[model samples]
Target: MAEDTLVRVEHLAKKFCRDLKTSLWYGVQDLGAEFVGKKKEEDIQLRNKEFWAVRDINFELKRGECLGLIGRNGAGKSTLLKMLNGLIKPDKGRIEMYGRIGALIELGSGFNPILTGRENIYNNGSVLGLNKKEIDGLLEEIIDFSEMEKFIDTPVQYYSSGMKVRLGFSVAAHMKPDVLILDEVLAVGDSGFKIKSFNKINEIMRDAAVIFVSHSMPHIANITNKVLLMENGVVDYYGENITDGIERYFGLFAGDKERVEYNEFATIEDMKVYASAKYADDPSRKLPAIDYRDPIRIDLDLKLKPNVEWFHIKLQITDKDLKIVGIYDSFQFQEAIKNDRDLHHLKITIPNSIFIDGEYSITVFIQQRDPINSKWNLLAVYRYWRKFNMKASAGLGYVPAVVYLPGQCEVV
Candidate 1:
């Protein structure tokens, strides 16, 4: 481990039951019973099998640096976080950390649902190594920060889910440990609270190294000074910023430079992603950047396999904060087609009138369907947020707000 490393993880692995073999056996057995009548209770037994959730992964967190963790669902982010916090032991590998740590690994991992908010505060604080006097000094500030003052004496069960998260985060935030690990806790609570919570996080970020896991790339880009991408149990890429990590993530499955000829679904058999709509060229410049009161365009060129339905596509624009700005769907508001064709050239153009002045980005989704209701196809997705002329608040002397709406008056 480097002297600058605050935490180091090497050859870590965790496994879980996957593809219940017994379920398959029973399911197969049931197929025979369809011809024989009701399944005989005495003859059937259920079975489950185990699989690796994470394997042979390795990485290090430098002091005062922000590291990101990203993978598809079930790729073991939460499992890795648990291992980092010493809440769970890895089936393989070792992790070493230097110093007092604070983690809000999940929304509410250490709380006692039955305890009063007041009691839980002390309990959690004590666990974090605060003496009773120290806890006392910080109690009121925690309650105030959480905005759960009214419910301080109430049982935590009586609190709403947001309240619980606020309380938990408030405690963790006040502890000010040497290292902090934040999972996707930002997804919880109301928008206003989320903003407040993020501000608090930024405060601690000045000194503590933060390990963040989120599906929200925009946040990852803005907050993380560095990144490490994990794929198939390996540290696929690690860099000075989030963009490099994201490109590495896309490359693992997309592999834009390679030609893949095999696909189980005919709808996607010929679907080769020559270049992403977001990354028409270099991905470093491809991050989403929507200027307020300006138009944005997403062009798509695709060749589809036969036996595919007319596809519906959706393009969503969001502010840098990862809030939705506008949604454009093919079936709802863009170009359309009636036949199952081999190729398509389509573009979605967003007029400047829709958004409030802010920094924003784009995400696209596509599915197959008819005019009435299109059943979604799973293969299409693209996200851009960090790279852009898309932001800048139209500050390029284009006050020109999100909309002109003509016929203006001269200040009555």
Candidate 2:
């Protein structure tokens, strides 16, 4: 590895056994082989019930670079990160890292449960190669940033998940490691703390290499200069183009883009839908993108389980940031009544397609009103599909929203 290259990974792979007994037995065999100073080639070969957790992955990170790792759950992201951080060894290939590394991989991952928060800070700082003087110089700032002043002396076991994340991130941020690795643990914090964490991440990215893993596309777009899309334990897409990588991820779920048919005590099914009015003429045709001049029409085929009375449905659209930009409710809009019918069809239309250039997703919610307070009760929810991308207009530099309505021209 060169001075500029902070982290380098080549042909990295990891495998795991499906059966716990088999895994433990294999571990024992490998230990015995090591004890006898004998090489076991069968250790690398997959047997009855085993699968690759991560396979043939390669990437490099340089100084001042933030590489975004985007993928669905169980795509071997955490395994790869564990390998890079020396928490686990790769089954094959090499990883060379050149500096002090700071990692916040999991919630409450490194903190000692019985230790005070203050002690944990000092402990983690020491682990990052900071001396006592250096830790003292940054102690106050770390406490202030974590917002754990009142509970700094309290045992970490009593701290909430959010408190641990705040303290963990603050310590990692201040350690000034040559490389930083962060997982999707920031969701445990409140919005205010999330903003502070993002700010600190930006501050660290000025000179350090960062590997950020998040399902949030907006966070990846805003913070990272490059993106890596993972699927089925392999790097499906790795490039500098964020949009392209996001599109590839969206495309993965677009085929039959619907959620589970039954969850909890209810059943919702066959939510075949359309994106814009143009597709309504041929309802069987695939949903198309909404043209700025056309109207947005979403057709839903809802079927309720027997014995269910009245239910309300809401349509909401969200940007990459996961912010709700457009929302409409069946009850609020006087669309339909909940009946005992097993089959129901709905068509929702927006008068104008007024969004700027960006990818958006449609989320549907089924609810019933509470008998006591008449408040809406959610029953089922689904993100129908997310292939909608409002094309950019020629003059607009960067439209910052899903839909921007022109206001009245009365400047008094």
How do the predictions measure up, each by TM-score? 0.59, 0.75
The C-alpha RMSD in Å for every predicted model, in order, reads 14.1, 6.3
lDDT of 2 by residue, 86-157 (tens): 898777888988888999999998899999999998999888888899999999999999999999999999
Candidate models: Cα lDDT each: 0.66, 0.80
Top candidate when judged by TM-score against the true structure: 2
- Candidate 1, run of 10 with poorest lDDT: 267-276
- Tens-digit lDDT track for model 1 on 1-412? 6776788888787655456775467457657876788654343333357556677777777776788888666667888889889987665678889877888887667888788989998998888888999989999899999998888898887777788779888888888677888888767878888888778877887767788887766567667777767665556676774555754554455222222233233322222222223345565653444443455655566555565555666666564444665677777765545336666766556555345433444455555654466455544555541123433333322232333343456976
Question: Looking at model 2, how many pairs of residues clash?
Answer: 0
Report the C-alpha displacement of residue 351, candidate 1, in angstroms: 12
Tell how far residue 272 is off in model 1, in angstroms.
Answer: 16
Index of the highest-lDDT prediction: 2
